[model samples]
Target: MEFGEKIKELRTTNQMTQEKFALRLNVTRQAVSNWENNRNLPDLEMLILISTIFHISLDELILGGSTVNNMTEKLIKDGSETRRAKFNMITTLIGALFLFLGAAFFFIKAHSVEYIDSSGILHENFYLLPTGFFFIFIGIIIFLTTGITFVNSYIKSRR
Candidate 1:
């Protein structure tokens, strides 16, 4: 069942009016109405609060239905484009994070020389190595390549 359905079910089971629930949540009665009708979703904090007030775990409240499982199965079976879009988005985010971390490491190494010997002459800093820059470059390349792949896949799947 969708979250709204669960909310309505729980509310009815407890015999609580929308007005009462709304008051408890510090929201308007219309907001409760909206939630029950699936017109909108509650924010994470409110969702947690609702689960707590109803004495149910978030997992139980959100995912305790065979209907939801069947829906997921159907979506997976269908291989819908929407799923591809979601995958592309996830891959893009992962690639971006890797690239950012790699770039950061590269910057840290490139700037390490600033903290070198007071002699202001040629010296070696064991902490800073040429390999660091190489890794950073590799990271940026991976990020760009992955980003391109994600965009391409997203576009192709849309078609």
Candidate 2:
């Protein structure tokens, strides 16, 4: 049996109405209705709570049928999406930081002193220029890579 069907069986067998079950679970009636209808699922914590309230072991509650597969699929999908979002956010922040650093190094005037050796030849440092260019290069690469991936994913999703 599906999780929703199982939940309905348990609730009805216990002589509890949807509203009463929702009250027991501290959720809304609509939430219970949705669960019973397989529109969505509660989180893991809620699942555990449901098992406890139903006076069933977790295995009995979750493993009698295809509920295990359904719950596993949901968990995997949610985890994957969360990880992808975090990865995108972190990469974006890192790319922005690199760009800011590059701009600072390139545009901010360096205050290094010019040194004259015994030969009286003045030597100036230009390290900041190269460093800034490197930073900017890295930032652009990061942005382009991330943007392309995002666009590709968006296109695939649209299809």
Candidate 3:
């Protein structure tokens, strides 16, 4: 049985209502409902309280049935992996965006020309080159760091 099912079973077996259980746990009735419905999980303290109140071992309360421990471990691991993947994707995208901006600035700087004003004075507007190079350097750093991190995480997950 799932954790939620186990909670519900214990509550019902002890002739306790959801409101009563929530009151004992110092939480809202909705919290109890959520737990029973598996919409959310209780934190460690609450889990301990549950086990204590129900007069059951923590292992029994959490495990509920065979393989539950394994399943929970797998779930946690998967969630972490998913978060890592998302981070990698976001970093890669931001790095690419920085690189594009840098390249665009560099292009503009290179194509810029010096022109004479109405006063017949020569003027140069080549300041963008330095800024472009700076951006390029920053972008490359971000790209390399994130890429390496992503590769490392991917390899780690494979094991």
Candidate 4:
């Protein structure tokens, strides 16, 4: 039987409704329905969870009644890698946004002008300058760390 069929059989044999199964998996009922209909395949984590909940081996859950091969491991690895790549991309983008905001603040601070008041007293708005520098420093650190992490992950994935 197919993976979806297997899942349906297991759910029915356990006397659980699709909604109940979805609740146990922390997913929506539609997601469970999709899985059962073979509209989509679950990620490695979800597959592992299903195996654990059903007391079945990953091999059986994934390969059904077929013999084990490198393809099964490859599928799991590819799914995991895709998830990691997406996470790294999001983190890098957030870090870049922080860096840009920090730079903009620093630029604004640099252009601030001092003025002489009616009493001939010089007034300079320097309070925000420190804040600007702090932001710039933090942004640089975050950008660097995130960039490094992305690069490292990329390199590891290539190998």
Total backbone collisions for each predicted model: 0, 0, 0, 0
Q: Per-residue lDDT for 58-156 in model 3, tens only?
A: 878877767655326645776797898888788888888888988999788778887999999988766777777888888899889988887787798
Candidate 2: residue 98 lDDT (0-100): 93
Residue 143 error for model 1, in Å? Answer: 3.5
- Per-residue C-alpha lDDT of model 4 across residues 46-155, encoded as one tens digit per residue: 98999999999988888888654343656867879889778777776776777677677777767888899999998876766677677667767876887788789779
Q: Give the TM-score of each candidate.
A: 0.49, 0.81, 0.54, 0.48
**Model 3 segments more than 4 A misplaced:** 1-68, 118-122
| Each model's lDDT | 0.71, 0.84, 0.83, 0.80
Best by TM-score: 2
What TM-score, to 2 decimals, does candidate 4 have? 0.48
Q: What tens digits encode model 1's per-residue C-alpha lDDT throughout 6-70?
A: 88889989999999999899999999898778777676688689989999986677565755633
CA displacement after TM-score superposition, residue 150 of candidate 2 (Å): 2.1
Residue-wise C-alpha lDDT for candidate 2, range 1-159, written one tens digit per residue = 677888899999999999999999899999999988989988989989999998897776666564465655677778887887888888989999999999898666375667899999988767888989899899999989889988887798689
Q: Stretches of candidate 1 above 4 Å error?
A: 69-140, 149-159
**What order do candidates take by TM-score, descending?**
2, 3, 1, 4
How does residue 57 of candidate 2 score in lDDT? 79
The alpha-carbon deviation from the true structure for residue 123 of candidate 2, after best TM-score superposition, in angstroms, is 3.6
Looking at candidate 2, the ten consecutive residues that score lowest on lDDT are 63-72
- The C-alpha local distance difference test score for the whole of candidate 1 amounts to 0.71
